[model samples]
Target chain A: MRGDTPFIAGDWGTSNLRLWLCGADGTVLDRADGPGVAAVPGRAEAAFLDATAAWRAADGPLPALFCGMVGSTIGWVEAAYHPCPANVGSLASGLTRFTALGATMAIIPGLSTRNPQGAPDVMRGEETQILGALASHPDLGIGRRLLCLPGTHAKWVLLRDGTVVMFQTGFSGELFALLRGHSVLGRGTDGLLPQIGPAFIQGVQRSLTSAPLPHLLFEARSRQLLEGMSAQDALSFLSGLVIGADVVGGIAMAADGLDGPVTLVASPILTDAYAAALAATGRDTVALDGGELALAGLLSVRAAILS
Target chain B: MRGDTPFIAGDWGTSNLRLWLCGADGTVLDRADGPGVAAVPGRAEAAFLDATAAWRAADGPLPALFCGMVGSTIGWVEAAYHPCPANVGSLASGLTRFTALGATMAIIPGLSTRNPQGAPDVMRGEETQILGALASHPDLGIGRRLLCLPGTHAKWVLLRDGTVVMFQTGFSGELFALLRGHSVLGRGTDGLLPQIGPAFIQGVQRSLTSAPLPHLLFEARSRQLLEGMSAQDALSFLSGLVIGADVVGGIAMAADGLDGPVTLVASPILTDAYAAALAATGRDTVALDGGELALAGLLSVRAAILS
Candidate 1:
């Protein structure tokens, strides 16, 4: 066995698994992608073995650290939730341990908090990403800030001194997809959410108003039928409206409000739309790459474990 | 051909067509159901012909009055929209006429209005039902009232002196189905919306608060996973939330601020949920059957034509 001690970092989610084989210096030496926990069900043991077979073969079973839904109830190991006011340290402090298929592994626990309404809210993977973002950009560690992670379930984190004080989840991205796939608003256009267009800009502007979302959503089709808006534009407009609502709604729910420019942890595709939406609302944003932050978050967890 | 001048009343919407062969006095002699305009496209004429062939043979192609999306641009004939501040008289006066395939037919025009933001809004079938509601219960013509028509696209009409002064459309029902069929909120539940349960009642209560809808929606799943909310109850809760949002949101948009108890024109399945939501919000409701009103609206159109 080539025993130089290269470690494995994984961001396993509901849909897919991403593994980064990193050298001692945290430089990626190799990578592997495989079916996510959801995709493999009871076969997660075999799936993991198959996915990282090469890495395990090259090095003699490196100790792996994982984050995301991999630690969820439906995931590899049911990692208990660490209640909030949780920070990166708290998450790293509570790792669920397991030994399977000749490899030792650990999963970072998710964060749990009661919303203002006292309803329990939980996030599995996003917490790890947020921590990673915090670690990657040390500047974000200062002051009270709003951190937005846009996705199927977009999270708006209220951070104070590098700890997640409270957070809100919006079903904006998933609802946008649901509307596009199943509603009349979805009619008349291809579903790809292109860059921010005029229709999308209109949606963002409308979101700043007091109009009800259920009513405002109908505009996607009404604008098309009455104004002769193209279907493609309608798709972008739908996206903008959903995102805009999230931003506007999220801001109102923030206990401290946004004290400074919001930090956006998003992929490239989402960067422009969210930036434009934020700009429209007269707010500034700092964009950070989500993939990079996720990797960094996992690496941070590894450090916490090794130390 | 036997001819007693019996009239045909048709409610043609996007997905299905429901028709009644009524006696001279507006009593239902027979009924027929077929695919809606969206289902048959260019074949609408032939489909209508096939749907009512037996009745046509007996009644010798009596005068037929149609309402709903059959009058939309995408329907049988592009019946023009009668602008709001419109009444039964205006709608009846704006019938688009056509003769095709051995039948004299007229489609009652839909109504159009600009939202407070000047965005163009239009409704076809619901307008007819509102008129029919007025015709069926003459008491409803007095003073000011709020009329709610719950369906795929629920409509809230502001009625003053028997005229529809303005209206708003909510995608609540459509959104409910979309979420149920295609969203994570849809998970952990059978899609059937049961009667008002504790989960549903909880949703209605939640809607009355200032919680953002996009955020509140995630509770459908969160409640399930965290609080042991059942799938069936989650479905009902989802329904309650959507309906609650529409009612609460619709009230805020009402220019006259609901002069009296709202009149909910809904099918049986939607009646309890909407009524409960309205009640929870400290409002009373007068329930009316949508189907009967649709038939009455068609009869009113026939009277408007013959008179």
Candidate 2:
């Protein structure tokens, strides 16, 4: 039963590379990883080959489906962005295919749309994750939906009739990291939020009241000095403030244009923060595990290619 | 006049220390500078001694007056903060006096006030700058006034009847530096805005329309990639967005409570940016040189101490 060679599913981005060897039944049979597109030097052909050598030796030359920053202009092979509104079928059709080292290969294209200000916004791997979410829950495709993928660059997406119509990018997560590590206001914070605490809720309340975030961020430090806030509490407060601002700003940008139950496709860590922020603003979220969606997306693309 | 060295006026901060030898007529005779408190490894006494050695050789034992981070907890000697509403008289009375290196020395205390959110807000050297502004232009002491000093830590101060009632700090400048150097949004930006251009105005307009700043900042990169914005334009655009956010947010925080023309006390470089941003928001500003105010503030404090 295990004699048959399988396909490879790769998620490569700026920071790290994650891979899975999937059987014909769509179950993961083996795993592999390597440096991300940013960390790999030269052509990246060697690194890819090296990362998968053992699996290749066991399974023979197998076809691979890759997503994320590997398709970016700065990545291995630049697969140009496909304009939305696009669905799973359209995304698969746009995949840039190539062959090297006796293996079939395909790289998923990123998505681009005009933001609220009518400027271009983009996302790479998350598009596949969205596709995977659609695959897992057909009911999610029935109506208009708002989807959020929270991470270093949080993406707030609008899906109309199963196709991603538009999206916006917020630098909230990146900002939190930068400020916590390198800023005076974030000096005392340790960059961890174990549980949603009082400080976090207070931060959400403050963000709702405070306009223009830069003016209020310093309170992270000031509160510690004046009110004896702990480092962990300060981090939580900062997180809530950023998330609250994102939610408020995202809604304002949406401006009643999109409607549906909000589907949050993120890791548990991010989901907790976003869920709390959304709840504070009187909105509820349906959580979707990002890893499951990612795998499902890879399988859908693989099936499309084989067909 | 050249024969007499009346006293040493120093603006010592976390990063840099500037000193001036002043004559009895309040004219600067000579100047020197050195690394600030943070740059000095162990004790700051040595750096202070070295910086003023030339002045000491000429003047014997001149009294010194310092204002800035030199009075902070991490500075030369911990000069405790004076609570507002405080004017020059109250500020002078809070001075921490000491005798070292056969020189009579005193450091002006920083000012602290609760912001609109009831969080602690503080400023050190800028307090002396405010005092200097009052000394140079007596008219500034009248009515309720707002003062903005834009820098690494931009300060927005409210003065009522010649006393500083309250203030807020925005880390706009530092954020700009960090983003430009460290964050992805600031990539390719040279961090120089030779003059405000169309790109800059566009940034201000975008910021005004886009409420939550963290969401909108990504436009700096999106515009460049989508519309082919040049690095110089991108940098200018980023600067405008930051200034705009600070101005808009600061006004909202003020909440129609503090009423007066904003006294922008800064160097020519910062004044240009803040002035343009304020003008864009339909607010006029009265400009004052930061150096002039720092000297005036020191002289005022010295006079207070002597009297």
Candidate 3:
């Protein structure tokens, strides 16, 4: 665990696994990907070993750190959730450690909290990204802020003084995919990406109203039938509707209202969509790369364990 | 057409076709079913002929009247939609008449209206039911009543003096199916009907809040993961969530608040679910049999055309 000892870090989720080989100085030397925890089932150890064979060969017996669903019950080994209000130190101490394939490995525990509605909510990979963002930008750890991690299951997180408080999960991404792929609303928009234009903005605006989502969603189909909206625009409109609803719900879930710029930790595509939707609601946002934050979060955990 | 001449009346929709063999006095002698518009693309005429061959052989060539999607562009013939402020008279006048297999046929046009959101909404089979309900219970036509026809695409119709003024279509039923069959919320519930008990009532209460649906939906999963909610309860909760949202939206979409008993036209199962959800909202509902109403509606259309 010395400062100059090279190691491997990973963010393994339900769909995919990403691994980064870091030098002793915490610089990323190389990166690789393998089947996610879900893909390997009982063979997660084999998949992990094969994905890092080259790295282990070059840097013998390097310790490894992992985050996300790779620590869930279905993962290599269960890393029981770290209850909120959690931070880097708590997560580092709670890591599920074990030896497999002649290498020491630690999987970061996910975070669990009760949302404002008094329902349980959980996040695995996003906690690392949030911690990484805070560590990389120390100023963000000083005051209350809202951070949104948009993905298959978007997270709306509240941060105070570098510690994670409560957050809500929105199924907008998954719902959108299901509707677009399996519902009648997606009749003609096959293999087409959502276009963020007037239709999308209109959908966002519509979502802000008092109309229930199930009612508003019908407009995606009705508009095409009556208004002659193109298939691409209908898809875009559908996208806006779901994302807009998520953003609206997220803002309401935030405590004391969002008085500051919300930090968005996501890939560029999601970032753009979220930023646009947030802007439509008269809110400001600061964007950060999710991968970079995950790496930084891992490094912070490494530093914590070492200290 | 004479008053004592036997005729065939049908409610042909997207999924299935139900036909009633009516005596000259409008009494139903027998009933048969056939494939819907979606099932027999270009072979609608052939399917219709095959389904009614036995009846035709016994009664000779009888005139037929049909309603619902049988009039859509995809049906046997495009019975163009009758615009808003439609009544029995309007629907009868708008019927698309034709001759098929040496028998005269007339298809009742669907109703089209722009919702309060200024978006076009259309209904095919429900319009017939609404008109039939009004014809059957004349008292319901005297005032401003909200009639909810719950089905695959639930419709909330605003009736004024027996005329269909404006209505909104809620995709709740379709959405519920999609989520239950394909989404993560439906994960472990295989072929189980939603039990409308505490979980469903709780979901309905939850939907009445300001929270966005995509966020509230995740509770179905989180509760199972953390609170030990059974798969059946999760499915029931999901159903309540969608249906409750639809009711809330329908109330909002109503030109005036629901001040009277909302008339529910649906099958027994849907009636029980909708009635329970509506009751939870402090709204009184009067349930009617959908089949009886559809038949009554078709008979009313015949009377309108004859007059």
Candidate 4:
């Protein structure tokens, strides 16, 4: 089915648009990118064409599906956000279509949850990974499961019988940046944690406990100024705080008693940190690569539509 | 009683020191400042003398006492920190003596608590205000109460019948500065929150319930860029989140179902913000000006030793 399509995968985000030219077997033939959703609101299609100008096949009529934030309100086309308890069944509403670079493109919608008294919770990019997860783990598509997706956002998502039952997002990256640069706890030393002694692990364990996080953070500076905890140690402590919070909070909400095996889809660094946190909590997890999941997800969606 | 002794009230923190000269009746007669604990160690008495060189009187022994971080480990002289449960019966630790400006000076020690885990919960300059609260509102010292002294480091303190039960610190002001300068939400309008209209109130309200505060901040910014929430309003939203979190998370543990009123001691602007938060939560509070409370505390401690 993908033979009719020139290429199959796209990871569209707030800041960048990445598209691939693939063979029928999904092998990378070529690739092109341009100003992402952030730069082009009304002219997303035009921008994509402009970027892919000379390389785009003259008469391919290639049909490609896009994933990530492209389906957001700010994307090339808006895709209706599917709510939690979302699976293949909840994917129908809030779909927007558009033509860009002479290729038929569809943006995938994220998920949403209506808070009882405030704004609703909404997401844009992680849905692709869920589809990919379902593709690789066929047994998980129809069962209770916990999926942890890591990035600027670390989402702890729960699935009940293949449907996303609930989800929560934490600002682990933002916190890491804030603590590393702006906060007193930040040590100016870069790449200090991943190469050190037990500092990183110590921080992970320290943050794993349920002590009020902020109170624990105050010590990051106080110890340095008072009891002499070093800046490097402080940085690790801060990192631990964010990672610990994400792992503990996300796991608590997503695992719901750890009834199911956990699947973590993220970069290696993140997986290592999560593994460290898991060890502290005496829990085990399955770590998967982000790129692989992303490709698998796009292929699955394309197959479902063609059928 | 109102004789020749010079009265001094101090606002001491970890970084700097400010002292007010007063008559026995607590009337302001002059003012001075010093390098504080951080700038110089083992030389607090000398630096203090230098700052007050112009104001030093040739009269009888200038009986002067000081508070703040000046008495911390890095300050002029370390005062003997007393364990809390500080009732009127047992005043905060006695002031230690030091030679400064060729005169007798007393440095008031902060209060510290020994947790069950054996870690010390310490307070320096803030103990002066707590002492003042006990002197001014004896009823507050008689039972379990929550006292909020809002400033750079807003301390939410709990007391059980005059014993310092426990306390937590929230850096609302420090956070305000960090967010205003470092983060994307830093583009706030100049000055206090009251000038910002509903954005200020709404911001504070949002912080109380916002799931992940940092992520929610983008809405404050983008709502203006894409949805038109206003720049000044966006800034206020950021402020509200920090202040609101200060109010909610700072006391989440100490004030849970605990009976009695919340007493707030801070400047006018912060007091108003706290009042707004209290109103949002349907909790009425007794707000006393920070300067006045510190003065009251200085006098009470002065009387205890002088008599």
Candidate 5:
């Protein structure tokens, strides 16, 4: 495969899908989105074809590379998880290859590792993001680095010389969603948006204490009843508490004595929250766009496969 | 107000209402139930009147005493929170009295106190349960005691000479329910009942570490995916993690340096789970029936009012 040959790349997850049509030099010529693996279930191939129908008709038989839950049991094809201490080359080699719609398609294997607690931890899409981060920043490939990818199931990865040594998964994002959408504390917060204001800072600082999360979370409601904290502030405060707990836990599990600015691979919104949280704990952070990193990661794997 | 004077007592919470028709001596004459305060909203008085219609017809103008969310803002009347360091006498004096359907009615004011973290904590029905526990066991009233009332918002209460001096609330039960009912970890667990088996013990033990909660919780999903853990065990494990975190946090907040077995004021199922979690940490537990305690507490309040 030539570097200039057009290709298709995607980062398909549980809830959404993003696909890019790239030129030989990895410039995104076009992009499309379709149902996530969860939505398509047994029909991932059909969904993928539908999402890229225009691109396929225009370009004719462009190879496709995918990462994330699209490789899981529920995905188009079950790609076996590449055991950690994995880098771009390992992931590329472990990719699950198949022929779909008369074109070569491969799903990048997710990474699996044992967390600090010796419990099994796994990452699907975030593995590609971390790899992309490493590819974009050569400096990050040196020595040791800690990367925090905030999402529905946030991943805290410890990288040694650009290889993912270990990682831990935090249920913060999903927990926050469930709480805000369903819990009692979220009762009157239907139209409210969480702000990075005093309430959030207070929640972050409160989460830093020895008080357990369950106890602290109730403050979202108690404060409203007792101190006149508005429902909007309450939502932000709840967000802070959840994210702060994740940061605290992630640092404990992955950072430890390792010294460096925690690399945050996420969108602007998540970066703002995570950066603020890390800053509160007196840790520095360097931000990277997760979307771009996913593309770069796919390119790196493509380079590896071609080589 | 003699001990054998027939009266109506009820515990009305967010989801359901439980009412008892008791003899003057506090013996149960009959029992009935109705929608909780949350269901009827501004029509709590009507709901109460409807639930107790049969009891009222059988026994005319029986004085009624209620506790729990019935006193909350959403309940029948907005009973003000009685500030703690409070005992049965203080609570009796703090009762929010009213007349509904031409009968003398009272709603026990919930207790309000600042948790160790200096955050506001409040409880409605649990206060009555605590008072009932004290009345049923005089030994509990003489010393500093720690009581764990497990429910939607589990309460950890510290008692000094029968007065609720301080307390903390853990959102463990609600979190567990939310995760089981809504989160990804709960998928495929529709009909499976959580058992206190190896997975639960493992979860409890896992939560005892300093790894923080969000990280520990994800193990339920990861273990299932990678280690072949069943949905049943995963639900139990998830339950253990949430409950264990609460127990750990509760002890740190309310039971610090306090001696004697932790008194668990809850129903049998909750008792089983809480006891298992506490026992894993070498903490001794004494279980008491929550329903019985509610009745006993109501009787104590009636006695105090008469005195």
Candidate 6:
């Protein structure tokens, strides 16, 4: 066992588990990654330990703070959710205690939702990213900001005064992967996204409205196969639908209204995909870096653990 | 040579290739199924010969009548298209002849699109089914009937006055498979489709006209995952969306504007699924036996060859 730092932070998602060794200042001095909780299933604790065992020292204890899905019910430990209008504490205060490699380890809390009448919709991982984004960009922390973290389960969260007001999720990416890679449309796409053009925009507009569009999709590929629409062009048309559907979903959530510019907080690829989709809607908004938010969240949880 | 038979009939599709030995009496003395045209690709002729080479010893020299994608540009040979309102003679009259098995083999023509700019969507194999159906159900030959052939590529053919008026295709079956097998919803479903109580009808209604459905289908699994919607129930709900969407599509194609009874021609499983979907729309339909259509189609083609 080796001691490179006194603290460790981890980002756990469905497919990946990443741990970072940091000093008191929150610099990622060393990092480790493995299959996240979802991928390993019921072994969140073991997975976490395995990733950081090398960083453990024979000479005593180090404080480790965790964020992301590790705090989920299926996570390293359950981090009960704090409802909307939350604070930095709303994101970081609810702590789940644990010990690994004889080091003091704790997992941060996640957020939950109570729809009009159902059981609470809890989110353990994304809440951490929200906290990180807010801590990094204090300006976005003020007033209402629309935070879009696009992924397998793209989260559309609304925030006010650093608190999560409300949020929803979309399966856009998953749908895209299924449609283009595994579906009959897969033949029309050939693993390539169509170039964004009029077809893409038209597809977006079609997805956004309540128009009877079930039949139009038949034409998406038929046009290419029967009408000679290029394969690339056909896929671009399809991308218009997937991305367009995403924009429509996010816009619907924000129907309550937006007081500030839409602050899209996501990885570059997803953020750009959303931008393209939203562009089809003819709406403009500002984009913030997703990595920065993740960092800021680590810092926030790190401080909360020290406190 | 065995006996005198004027023609040989073949049905070649994506996964199955079937051949029939028909006498002048239109009696199927023998029948067989092998890997379809798509599987054999460029070697379709050899594959066809290999499947029926036994006939070389007899049946004299006869023309081979074939249908389906076997006549696609990518198939063994390109069959010229007979536009909508095509007849049995219309299909046979425009046939493209190619020599094979030391016999005069004439591959039946395919249907083509009316789209001026794009490729005319056509069907080689299905045309024979239509011919078969018309011959067997001459009663159905009288008026406008919707010929529903549900499969990977579901075809909706409108027949008027015993002639195919206009037709459209939907990838509904394919979409259903991909969505339920490859998407996250697939995870919630576990590859089995159950009956969707009210959520399915609700989903169908919402999808047909709702602008920006909330929860992005996380709700489908959410009800199950968080609120106890059963996997079977969720699968049913998912099935409803796809099938319901397909119905909405067919309705959209009808100039009548979502106001007609859909005659769903499919197998028992697909028929039930369609019935479940049509529940929400409250639209009634006649579900015909799939086997009857195939048999009738084969017999009709056999009779036509002798005539």
Preferred candidate (DockQ higher): 2 or 4: 2
Q: Of 2 and 3, which scores higher on DockQ?
A: 3
The predicted structure with the larger TM-score, 4 or 6, is 6
lDDT of 2 by residue, A107-147 (tens): 98998898765778888999999889988888778777888
Estimate, for each residue in A151-192, the C-alpha lDDT of model 1 and write its tens digit: 998888888888898788888888887888778888755646
DockQ scores of all models, one per candidate:
0.70, 0.70, 0.84, 0.22, 0.85, 0.31
lDDT of 3 by residue, A78-100 (tens): 88878899989999999899998
**TM-score rank order:** 3, 5, 1, 2, 6, 4
Write candidate 1's Cα lDDT for B117-220 as tens digits.
Answer: 55778898888888889998887888888888888888888888899988888889888878887787777656465568777888888777766578789888
Error of 3 at A102 (Å): 4.0
Per model, state how many residue pairs clash. Answer: 1, 0, 0, 7, 7, 15
- Misplaced by over 4 Å in model 1 are A1-4, A116-118, A253-259, B1-4, B253-259
TM agreement with the true structure for every prediction: 0.95, 0.93, 0.97, 0.77, 0.96, 0.84
State each model's CA lDDT, in order: 0.81, 0.81, 0.89, 0.66, 0.88, 0.66
Interface RMSD, all candidates in order, equals 1.4, 1.3, 0.8, 4.2, 0.8, 4.7
| lDDT, model 6 | 0.66
Between candidates 1 and 4, the one scoring higher on lDDT is: 1
Error of 6 at A102 (Å): 4.5
Query: Which residue pairs of candidate 5 clash?
Result: A3-A24, A4-A24, B3-B24, B3-B25, B4-B24, B4-B25, B5-B24
Considering chain A alone, what is the TM-score of candidate 3?
0.96
| Tens-digit per-residue lDDT, B1-104, candidate 6 | 11355456777777788777777565677777778766887898888878876775566555566777787766788777777778776665677777875677
DockQ of 4: 0.22
Model 4 per-residue lDDT tens digits across residues A198-299: 666666665555444444556555546545667777777667766776676665664336455678889888777777776677777888877667667777
- Candidate 5 versus the native: TM-score? 0.96
